[model samples]
Target chain A: MAKVNRSLTGTMGRSWLKDAQFTPLAFLAPTIVLLVAFAFIPMIWGLALAFTDYPILLSPKFIGLDNFRRLKDDPVFWASLRNTFSYIIGTVPPRIILGFVVALLLNQAIRGRNILRAMFYFPVVAPLVSVSLLWQWMFNTHFGVINGILRMLGRAPVPWLTSSKYALPAVMIMSVWKTVGWNMVIFLAGLQGISPSYYEAAEIDGANRWQCVRHITLPLLRPIILLALVISTINSSKVFEQVYIMTGGGPGYSTMTLVQQVYHSAFQSYEMGYASAISLVLFAIVMILSVIQFKYLGARTDE
Target chain B: MLRKFSVALSTMLALMLLISFAAAAAPAELRFLWWESPQRVESIQRLIDEYEKAHPDVSIKLESIPWDEYWQKLPILIAAGRAPDIMFMVSGNVQRYAEMNALLDLREPYVSQEVIDEMYEPHRAMVTYQGKISALPFTLTTVTPFYNKDHAAKAGIEPPMTPENAWTWEEFKLAAAKMKQAAGSPYGVGLGTRDFWLLPFIYQNGGAVLNEARTGSAINSPESEEALAFLQELVTEGIAASPVDQSVGDLFPAGLMPMSFGGHWDMARFETVITDFDYGVTFFPQRKTSGVGLGGDFLAVYSKTPYPKEAAEFVAWLTSAEANGQYIAENYYLSPRQGAKVTYPSRQEEMNLAQKQAELASVRLTADRAIPAWDKFLQVIHSEFQMVMIGDKKPADGLKAIESAINKTLQ
Candidate 1:
């Protein structure tokens, strides 16, 4: 028994130094180094920057909690923070629900399935800058196609991009339309992974289509759904381009997102330290949200 | 064989030293960088060619970056101690670069009293920082009201073509409403959505953006509130377009807007875009005074430039009356120099009014640049102003909010 234990320990301890194990790490070294250089180092640097007064053109001075203190009284900062959360809430659930529904429908062996799938996925492949620009034109109050359609329906044209009340909603609608396809593709992959035998078994047990979906499909797709939810939430929280291009965080601070604030502070204002502080707050919020999502959904997913 | 080898090596070494000396004797290479547009680039290149021709001992390498990317890259280059020998700066950024000690002083030997006297007082004030001339402004323009002739005729209103004939605040608003009603224009006037563009209104109302010492916002005063309230009324009544509704300056060219504020520089583009409508440039509408915000680019020498003397010489020459007048005339821009005689090929009538308006340009327009992070302050002002214009907040409330935000930056 002692010899067997010794053998197990020796093999395990020696395995990492062997060519087989060492080769994988050698291959991964470039990626690990790159990740550390680009991602982790900047993150740490950004955190450190939050504690200093760094004007981009000047040397950074240690300033303790001054930036954070300033942020507390900053109305724009508060408005942007509120907008970010609203954006996540407004975008993520709709994207996930719509994506899931579309995925379930497309999973059927219908005619033109491939063409339909490609059409839905087209938005995911289009460049975001152009997409945002196109949507900006489409959201124009008087001349836009959207407003034209509303007028044709005998409805008053909505001040989609101009009015503060509708600006955030307009941006969210564009974002959902742009990204729902991505989630659909993800859900489609997950749906295709589920075994058809489970449905057959449910059918043999005299289960109806709804029962089969409820008992079999949903339970199996639980982990994928949780994954999609978390990813969508994080992505929605970081929404910037659409708001930036479509509304420019205005008519008031209506469509301003946290990321736009970060860009504004850093590049526009050159207040790198304050920008870093905003970034840290954003990171912390995203981290907390992701942890809560995983904690709640991950448990059910595990079951 | 050793002796022969030694002699040959000595000969090669001497030749190498000669080549090194020849290289050291080459003309000083100075880098001049500026943001580019077609006419501006052509005019600048023309000046550079002339400068090079006159100063054979100095060579200049001209470089241009597109406007948006230029601001982003310039600061990084300056921070890295690789700034161009001479670079173009705007009046609003002069304070920033001066505060950073990135600009060379042009007061003493570089700029003469004759040259200083030739420049307009407001232009001189724009380049001055703490009693030192930090830059030499070349071309100057001011925001003026441009109107479509057909629309004005249709509305039966005469657009202000001179300072004396400029419309009063009430007349301007009433005329805008009239134009909207008669011409079927969506937005009768397009007030540009920018802090600088808004400054003309504030200054015309006898209001100052910042206090005497530039420590805090003075825009909370009754004068400024009244000015802003007028603007808010124009926007709320749909006499002027909101930035949200359409791209502000585009509507005029599209024939959707009857009147709009623009600089002399915009005339070139209008000459192309307004093919259908005959548009004429005029002075901004009057309040208490015909004060308009100045728009100009300055030539500044980098403090750390190795060829400071050459850079300063080029800057001085480029901004000289003869050189500057030719460049401005060619590009249809008003010269910043009071002594410079600029003549445009066409639109001489509009150019004359633009020149008159340029002289009336306000010093208070670029005063907020003295405050650090003025861009950020402008963002706050922009949003608050938008709220006021959209009737989401009162003018007084918006001004107070702007003051509070600006004061935070001051601290």
Candidate 2:
């Protein structure tokens, strides 16, 4: 028995239990356990739930692909998916471009640059609930500041939050204002990291400011921009708080997003299976979009 | 002398041990959970203190969650077997919880039939599920028309003070228009578009939202269509504030609207803020019938509570006339008890009018409204009706959509 124990611990399992690896593993055990318990296990369970009929009151029954089959015919599900995509398209590019432009302007020695940066960042730091409420008031049709300005200019008041035609756009505008600062700060960091000598060399070649930015700055910032795009698209696809607070996805189902639908299905309707199915579809969309972004942007970055 | 002193010390030690054991074994520590406004929470806490003082063998740990998160967390807690011994429930959730067997039936053995029958008819209906008393109604919030007196004076309209004097639907509309004409645009009637608030109109129009058997939709009937069209016209013609952009609570208190629909609970806030204008509560206008929406909280015992008998007794005590009177008087909320005595600190006239409205109110339940999925149905209702109110869809089309959606939920 003693000889067998020596061989097991000393020969085969010697490196596996070595101090170097064992110490790090011991240190990481808590985090790994937490991730498995909270994130990984729930993810696997959610995927399994998508294949069952779980109303949360009774025991779950395996229903195979019925949930997915139902999704194919669910109009609300289709509408929410369309709205999610529209939100991604409407908010992500404008945010990235505006953030970049603002970053570039602030990168120069301008008056009150620090104050301007802080002013831009304030909205990002504000609590989303308060910001959504503030924007709701600002978008009020009768006495809102926006309408106040419109009326002052002798123009008709727009029912910004109360109309289906403009609700999503209003949400998009608030989202951009609230989040542009985050992207700006990221782009500013990327811009500052670029070597000044590259710009100097380009300038010596009689390159204009636009050409210098076009060739050197844009190339250097490609990876950062890709990072922002992937992050923003994933986050924007899950939009809920603003739409929930501002319009409650209302005036019709015009402002409903995929995550809000998930909430409605799971909590409001108590259909866990259907909600999981919706979530699985959302997960696939986000994953595929991220992969496509990487495929295109990553290739350019490498060059 | 030393021996005597040692004996006395031993005796004292023995007595101390006995007292500590009694202290540890006493007090069952029942967990009570509820969702209410801060003012009501204080009132509930006082009731808990009074109950604890009266029953020396029991103590309560109070848990209050905000209304929005309460329903979402409650079923999960009950399913996990971690439910509170006593829980606050609403009328809409009573049927679902009873069907789930999560609530204790307060029938014969737990509560006598006489006591259950003693409750107001609508309140009794709210708690009854398949002839079983699922919960006992404690307080009620009934809708009444709250009007700005100054606006009414300007429009030369006397608000209805009694059901007999209630205006017809056409009269109500003409009055609203006159008020708008006198008091500028957006200052007429402030209407709420949610289904619960909208039910009064349907009821007054002699249209039921669901069939008699509660198996299908009755909202597509001509009566319902006319009722909905009338409401839509109020918004579209600028006789009512746009439900989309303005909250009636805000507009009413700001003196911007001549009249608005509010509940007994809304009186507290309105009383505090409407210093610029005097307001009065009265019966809602009548058409084919005189009716308004009825809703409130109920006290229920968790079926799985280890101390079921104690929990039931406590819930009974909490809803008793004496305890309910104290709570109602302090909060200005209406009691569900038939003859509960309560004295308002002020505004007795308005309170009396509200009480009259509640007495006329009926508890409206449909097959879809009683299920766990009713919240989703209400969301559909809100969206569909909002489309009509915003002029994107006709009332008939919206009603059709609602009918189909509700039938789908029933299935």
Candidate 3:
């Protein structure tokens, strides 16, 4: 009787374990296969090509590390690297600060709060291509609305898009406008997740609103803030569309960035191997940055 | 028996509909890809329709890609071994394609020397690389300077009507100064640093992009510096608009600026948009000689094409006098073929001007602009030109930098 009972229980346990593991795998197979085929396989292929001399029109010959050796002495690559770094530093901080402050403000009791929130979030939902195109007209050196208004105010016309001095800043301005709303939405959710009871408790302990925010709200929002920064770093580093559409990376290549260089080398010059080498350098830089962020910032909250 | 007879008759009629007029002959599908302005799509489609009607056994599939994206797509298509049978080629495109052994040589087997000689010299030279005719020039364009007639009239300056009578560098500057002094603020000339605009100045100053052998860049020489200095003075003196002030000057009505450099496509737009004012176009103002940059689109058959004869025949028909005349009339392009007779029915005057421009272009069109590294060379030149135009770099330094970059690319 004891043996029969044990055998039945073992059978039941095995069946339960099988069903638990089988269902999710069956559901996830298509997505996993697609990711491997499209993303992983291409990445590996690109990695291999980074070491070759594969001009797109010509047959690719394996010339190991030659592309990378050329990159060491390339001045244009260095200039583009500088411009990309400047773009990120110039745009990302403002975006995050503006977004968080607005999100904090909107979280409070205000008039037509939902409507205000919706207005702030509208640009986030709008397409980047359309937004950048609109900005292009707005930044036109002569007949743009901004210059028109400046002229009406008795000021000299500014060459917003044409001048090398101003073109990168103009692009940065557009990027900030496009991105702040997205970060605001994310920060808003994090702001809302904080319990009001903690604030009340702080208030009871003779803490002012600023003090309570300093001690409680910020600490609670740390993980979300870190995540937003990491994502912002990735997005700003990979900025291509805005620079491409607005400037064509010109006026002495003042606004040329890394991804634009990759695109130019690959598509325009037909130097695929060289482009891949540039891309790998970017990928490694991004990885190092991401790892640093995860280690220093992510460790604080995940623990 | 009567019902069975009726069913059999109906079945035979249905089978007849399934069979084409060519009687079970398999159609050879030729994919033809090109970039076209929206206005020209209808005309191109009409040409394709005519070609298809002429050859019942050959079906031509027309694909249109955006001009800005064509280079990016073309290489991928060729590398993937899925390139179209026939493609539209431009001056800078054929050299690369020919180098890759991707284009079929039209000199022998496909076309004869007599037929090639029928094209304008510059247009013919444009499609030739390594002594081989790689493609056939279908349309020609020479950069022409368009001036606002009303602006000139207001400034009491009568701009010259032909290259021979046009302003010298000093005279052009004086006219610009007079216009600015009269009109105020928007300036007189819209300076362009692009290849068509800047290269012509180099040619007009007795400079070419390269030596006759096309061995190296000639832009580092004294004449090239003189050409750049002329432009540099206009920029720094604030006589003409710099990119910092405005790029190619966004002045509209095509009539606000006294002069602007443009191509044939601008002719169509000016006709429509310049209704508020009147504009006149003339040959590029000369320095040492009257010259203009000549460039155009061409047709090339892919070496991998399954039906080379049919593709070549179609391209030949498309570039023939009758087809090209209609194409030019509808599309506002100048013809490349000798005696192609491109008469823009209502605008016979513009057609006459186009002929004059084409004639001027041939005098200085041959250069290193046809090198396989043409695109990269352009990039370096464009950057250096911008630097000089913006008053940031000295003309000598800019030219030296451009020459160095070109040498690096060539190596």
Q: List model 1 lDDT by residue over B1-411, tens digit each.
A: 999999999999999999999877888899988897876788788888888998887999988999978888888888777889999888778867887788999876887878877777777767778888888987786776788889888889988776888889999999889988887977889888777677778888888878877887888999889898999899888899885554666778888788887777787777777789898876788788765777688899998898888889889988877887877776678888775666787788999988888777776665554344577688888998899988999999999998998887786
Candidate 1 chain B lowest-lDDT run of ten: B364-373
TM-score of chain B of 1: 0.92
lDDT by candidate, in order shown:
0.85, 0.83, 0.80
Locate the minimum summed-lDDT window of 10 residues in model 2 chain A.
Answer: A12-21
Which residue pairs in model 1 clash with each other? none
Which model, 1 or 2, shows the larger DockQ?
Answer: 1
Give native contacts recovered, as a fraction, per prediction.
0.71, 0.54, 0.54
In candidate 2, stretches whose alpha carbon ends up further than 4 angstroms from where it belongs are A1-20, B1-25, B363-368, B371-373
Worst 10 residues of 3 chain B by lDDT: B243-252
Can you write out model 2's per-residue Cα lDDT over B1-411, one digit (the tens) per residue?
A: 999999999999999999999876888879999898887889889889998999988999999999989978887787677899999998688877777778898887788777897787777766777878889888877766788788778889887887889888888889888877776756578777566677778877888777876777888989888887987887788787665663445777887777887676777777788799788776787886775767777899888788888888889889888888877766678878777667887787888878887787755632234554466577778888788877888999989988888787777
TM-score of chain A of each: 0.93, 0.94, 0.90
Candidates 2 and 3, the one with greater lDDT? 2
For model 3, residues A1-303, the per-residue Cα lDDT tens digits are: 999999999999999887687778889999999999999999999999999888787878899999999888776788789889999899989999999999989998999989988888888789888888888888876657888999999999888877788989999999998889889999999988999999999989999988988999888998998989899999999999988878777677788899998998887677889999999999998888889888988898776
Residue B81 of model 3: what lDDT? 86
Candidate 3: which stretches are off by over 4 Å?
A: A1-20, A147-157, B1-24, B243-250, B362-366
